[model samples]
Target: MARDEGGATDSPAAAYVFRVTVRIDPEVEGVWTEPDTFETTVVRAADSPGDPGWLYFRDNLWRGECGDEAHMRAVAEDALGMPVDAIDFRELRTTQAYLDDLRAAMADDLVEFNAETVDAALSKYLGSSIHVTDDI
Candidate 1:
C-alpha cells in the first residue's frame, strides 16, 4: 500500500452486514418441519472495483433495503446450507475512505447503473442506511 505525505494508506476498507430472517412456511410444508421466524447473519465480502457492486440498485433493490429477498435467501442458503425464506438488510458499516472509493467507482459508470449521479445510485440501493464507522 502506498502512502501519501501524511502517511495515510490509500487502500479502501469496509464491511457489510445483512441481517436475515427465515422460517419454513408452516402452511406450505406443514408443521412437521417448522421453525419460527428468526434472525441470522449472512456475510458478503465487499467485492473489488471491477465487480460493480452498485448494480444491486439498478437490478435488485426493491425499496432501499433489499429489493430481491429471494436472491438474498439464496445467498444465505449457500452460506449456511439451509433453506431461507426471508432476508433483511441492516446497514453497511464502512470507513469514509472506502465510501470515497465507491463514489469514484460509481462515477465512472453512471449510465450502466441508470443513475444520473453516483449519490443517486448509492441512495437508491443503500438508502439512509450507511453508517460511517471508525472501526474496521
Candidate 2:
C-alpha cells in the first residue's frame, strides 16, 4: 500500500528529511583589502539515511593595481594546491567589496604595513609610490 504524505507517521521504516543551503565567499584577501576573491557553496540534506545532492558556486573579486588574471589564477592554484579551473574568477572586478575576510589580518598584532613597503608594491603598477594612509 502507498504511504500517506500527511503528518509524521510512526512507521519504523519512515525517515525524516531536511534541506540546507550555504553561501560562502572564500575571502582571498583581507576585508576591504585590495585584490580579494571568494567562493560559495550550497548543499542539501535528508535524514532518510540516503545521500543528498550537492551544489557549489564561486566568485573572485579584486581592486587596486588589478593583477593579471593569469597571475592571480596561478597564485590561487599554488596556495590551494588545486586545479586551476577550481579557481573561479567570474565575479572578479576592480572595486571595493564590503566583506570581513581581513579581520584576522587586521587584528593580528604581528602584521604591520609601513608606508614604504606599501608604496613599493603600489609603485610597481602605479608608477609612483603610495602610502597606506586609508583605514580600508
The candidate that wins on lDDT is: 1
Q: Please give, for residues 80-133, the per-residue lDDT of candidate 2 as tens digits.
A: 544343332222111122112122222332223222343332233333212222
Go through the candidates in order and give each one's C-alpha lDDT: 0.69, 0.28
Lowest lDDT 10-mer window, candidate 1?
54-63
**lDDT for predicted candidate 2 compared with the true structure:** 0.28
lDDT, candidate 1, at 118: 82
Best candidate, TM-score: 1
Count of clashes in candidate 2: 3
Compose the digit string of candidate 1's lDDT tens values, residues 25-92.
Answer: 45564355535667787645455555756444346554457777778778778887666777887777
